[model samples]
Target: MDRFESLAERRIREAMERGDFDDLPLAGQPLDFSDVDDPQWWIKRWMEREQIDTAALAPMVIQLRREADGFPDALRRFDREDDVRAYLEDYNHRVKQDRVESRFSRESRIIAPVVDVEVTVVRWRELG
Candidate 1:
């Protein structure tokens, strides 16, 4: 196996020698990376390119944050004020539970704040 090349590697090397990769689009041109200031830029781009949903790949805390952001509009789903309060309370409970459970894991380092149920209830009233 000393001088052997895998089939994929051999095909790639042969293609390179034949200049098959030459004259390709964007060859030798500078990449447009002006928007790479985000630390997770590559991951975000890959997800976009592959048509993957961010929520599918995100952890529970991140999903919760997303849910909280759209929750005000979602409050309309509950016809009664008590239902909204219960939903907000359940959301807060999940957030707190995640915080406690992730205390020592990598996700623990994420600073996800728990949703305030009272403030949300007030918001729900305003929406009403």
Candidate 2:
């Protein structure tokens, strides 16, 4: 450690002195942010920039929320009301489990609430 300069900072300073950053694209433009303290935050931003599917990286509740948004479509896979009801049961069971899991963590709970499968099934009928 030399004074307050970090290794990465020192390298960047040297590169600037050598004019290595002169010809870089968008070099003169201000960056929204270059440093993020949270690794998860950085990874999420990189995933977004790369157009990556980061559903696995998201919290269980967030994943559930996305699934819930498409729940009507999922029920469409079943031709019978009984099958639809069974699938809804399973989905709601998992949502309850996730809510319990959220209580065990001290970090921010991003878990969304469960959707009303009954109402969604009604909407599906209107669309049909």
In terms of lDDT, the poorest run of 10 residues in model 2 is: 31-40
Q: Cα lDDT of model 1 overall?
A: 0.82
**Tens digit of per-residue lDDT, candidate 2, span 1-128:** 37999889999999989998888888788876655666677777888899998677778888888888786876676777777777777888889998898898986877766667788778667666
Off by over 4 Å in 1: 1-54
Q: What residue pairs are clashing in model 2?
A: none
**Tens digit of lDDT per residue, candidate 1, span 42-116?**
988888889997666788878887888786888988888888888888888888888888886864476456777
TM-score, one value per model: 0.54, 0.52
Write down the lDDT of every candidate, Cα atoms only: 0.82, 0.79
- Tell me the spans in candidate 2 whose CA falls farther than 4 Å from its real position: 1-53
